[model samples]
Target: MKKYALATLISPFLFFLFTNCNKDKSNTEETPVKDTIVVKIDSVEKKPITTIDTVDYNQRMIALSNNDTTGRWPVKAPYPLPGALLPYNRIIAFYGNLYSKRMGVLGEYPKAEMIEKLQEEVAKWQAADSSVTTIPALHYIAVSAQAAPGKANRHNMRMPFKQIDTLLSWAKPINALVFLDIQVGHSTVKEEVSQLEDYLALPNVHLGIDPEFSMKNGEIPGKKIGTMSADDINDAIDILVRIVREKKLAPKILVVHRFTQGMLTNYKAIKTTPEVQIVMDMDGFGSQVLKRSTYLRYIYKEPVQFTGFKLFYKNDNWNDWKMYTPEQLLEFTPKPSYIQFQ
Candidate 1:
């Protein structure tokens, strides 16, 4: 009697183990694994993460599949931005420091060679895009002035207004944008922005802020450098929003650069602003390879547009340019709308 009782208990335990093992096997079969996934940005199931550097390759796959952008389905989820595409149709290239041409390498300004290099880069991208099926928007960088504390030759970037006019003339005909870059110093955001309001008035003009250069009294961001507060940024945004709406233009894109935590002031506030377009750009300017998968999955997946990038022809070679390319940034199967060429 004792031996039979023991067998009954043992049999039940064995059965449970077999069932669990089988269940796990079934799960394995149901889930597809992937190192990369490609989806169209506007299609359903895009599952775009925040940054491309941080996705885990070993994670089990769950497809977010959408065959066409026009597919409409019943859902409680709010609609994504209309006309959104996987891998955006715009290209942004930075060429900061108009007046620092004489400052040389240490000043971090692009000299004559850099200008030619950028024009070449633009031509190259244009050449590359010629054969593609979809058309992408192009914006050239035009940072205003230089600010290096009490330095004599700094912040003198009056920008000739002539250069801006020339750039504007060139961009308008080609249907490209001219992103005005700002490095706010001891001056207020409104004051600095007022200097370039004319450009913002243009339909294709966008705004870019370099917190790295927006310091006071010789401080650099991440090293006692001052940053623009949320209110400061919003003040600018308010004008932009008004301009875009009143003028009946497209939503204006605002770019805020961040290399570390402190650099970002009031991220939540900036994100929630009404009808404002914002991109939290990673302003890492070095060769140290970084892990991007985390940001892409967590942050890029949010409602706002998240960017994957690098400042090629500048720094951050620790990771290859291939990793930051529009095709590879964020492992986003659908691709990103923005790509930067330094």
Candidate 2:
């Protein structure tokens, strides 16, 4: 696994001070409505049926399978509660943190440039597969794993609310969905997720957890690849389920990042519910052949509810290997419904 460099702006001293002064306040602050806009859904019939239409949802799910002959696809999960974003719309997300340009595409360029680049990717995916509607997304790393243990010695740093507000403001212009991703170093998933309850309650905001930096064994993050068990994932699902039911919001998509078989354990024990949709994302980077082999071994064979493929613009081309085009990825068995660029 490739280790991401630490943010240039987040020094140990600065992060420690920020952690003590603002962590609690940011967690407790009310979610602002000015930056959030209702996501536009395409009408199914003469009337708009974005919310309670099971028939359309089922048909879309089948379409997403891309006529898979294997029984693993379209995992027979529960019909999501109204307002699910999965099969109806394919998500094309730019992943990274606002503080680090080396982290991903989301932070590699200026705000305007980044949005434009994301739009370009969205266009490419739309052209590759016109059957599903493409939704642009900003997959921001809200809680990032840190090389140096800060404040509580958790080896994870939470981005300030101001930074999150900035990302939300950026998303408003493009009507893009925002995902708050967490890479828990020494901290538990429950602890990290509980702090983001207010943000996760929003209709357009989703959740992603990276097992690569989970650090369940108390090893320093980035020194070695970490893992998450089914119980760990179930904890996140349970929290999201409660949020959806209590807030009466639509289903929340939960993305779990994985590249190796050991990164995620007890695959059969992971639970799925109507309130949460899970995507086991292939998060490795390499040559086309290597990427396909990783996907086939871990993502395709594991039989998750939904699958996602990740492309690295720089890393994929390390040995002059070209990145997989959207068309190339679309031809795989159980075509990926979620596509991410890093």
Candidate 3:
């Protein structure tokens, strides 16, 4: 959200209420960089990675809760079918759209520089908590909400398949995961997710839906904060379930971003299936206090299956304010399982 960076000039109270909206025009003319090379990991024979330890699942879950006595930290949800990632590995993702540098770190730096930065973050998180492994990820905004209505009269633009292919390539060399984030505007979640069936079928590819730009009431995106009902979230879960089952693939991770209470309604009704793991991400940028308050108010209080936190390099570091370090974030009531950088 561009407005997040302007908080210093405005009232702190008012700034906290504004949604992070990206209204930049989609740059479709740029072609994928075929020569881009991600860092190569050492080629040594290693034990096959286990997504979860069945016998110690509960123990791992408790460890992830970070001694939360609130009873809401380790959500009482069904154990995801084998090959799940949550509660086992903390995902460190860089979020943004390749078309807009202002969107996030994903597009702000050069491919090589961005990957290097993400690797450094992964290492920091690993060092902060050695209990859980850290997995680097690229959270790309595949479907972006637009300021202008397109041919479909929906204020959303879907990036071409080639762009997604490029992101997949970037993940290969580093052994990282990929998350395709969607920001629907004047469109439905089902409509947007259905279009990505091909990509979601892949084991390494996951999903993220942003209710901040949902625009369910037909309001133009970026003018106001939007919302997504439990049904909207369930729609996404349903799609991922079908993909996992039909393809006989591992469970997929679904991330939903929220900074305010209204952004996601009927939280209790959001279903968690064995084929899909849901992460309720606190997607806001501000002082460390404000960010923690927002997480507690919405994510921690709501009792989602898993939790995620986003860091804004420029927004959180504004006016002499420092961003939250991985060690500090680990002190959170229920340590975030997913960490995103914008």
Cα displacement (angstroms), candidate 3, residue 70, comes to 2.4
lDDT of 1 by residue, 1-342 (tens): 011121111000111222233332211221122211221112111332333221221111111111214222111122222222222333545443333322122124433444455455456555544422222233333332232222333332333455555555544443445666665645556765666665676655777765544565644222343566677777778878777667555556676655444444665455333335565555544322332532333234332343434344434342353325433342442233344544
Tens-place lDDT digits, model 3, residues 44-147: 11233345566688988888788988788688888877667777789999988776667788988999999999999999999989998898999998887776
**TM-score, each model?**
0.57, 0.86, 0.87
- Lowest lDDT 10-residue stretch of candidate 3: 7-16
**lDDT for each of the candidates?**
0.42, 0.77, 0.79
What would the per-residue lDDT of candidate 2 be over residues 1-342, giving only the tens digit for each residue? 343222111111122332344444423333244334333322121222356577877777777677877877768888887667778678999988766666788987999898999999989999888887788999988887766676677788777667776777787777788899988889989998988887787777889998878887789776677889999999999999999999887788899988777789999999989999999888867678877887788887888698898888887777788989988888887789898998
- Candidate No. with top lDDT: 3
Residue 83 local lDDT, model 2 = 68
Best prediction by TM-score:
3
Model 3 segments beyond 4 Å from truth? 1-53
How many clashes does the backbone of model 3 have? 2
Error of 3 at 51 (Å): 8.8
By TM-score, the candidates rank as 3, 2, 1
Pairs with backbone N, CA or C atoms under 3 Å apart (clashes), candidate 3: 1-20, 1-21
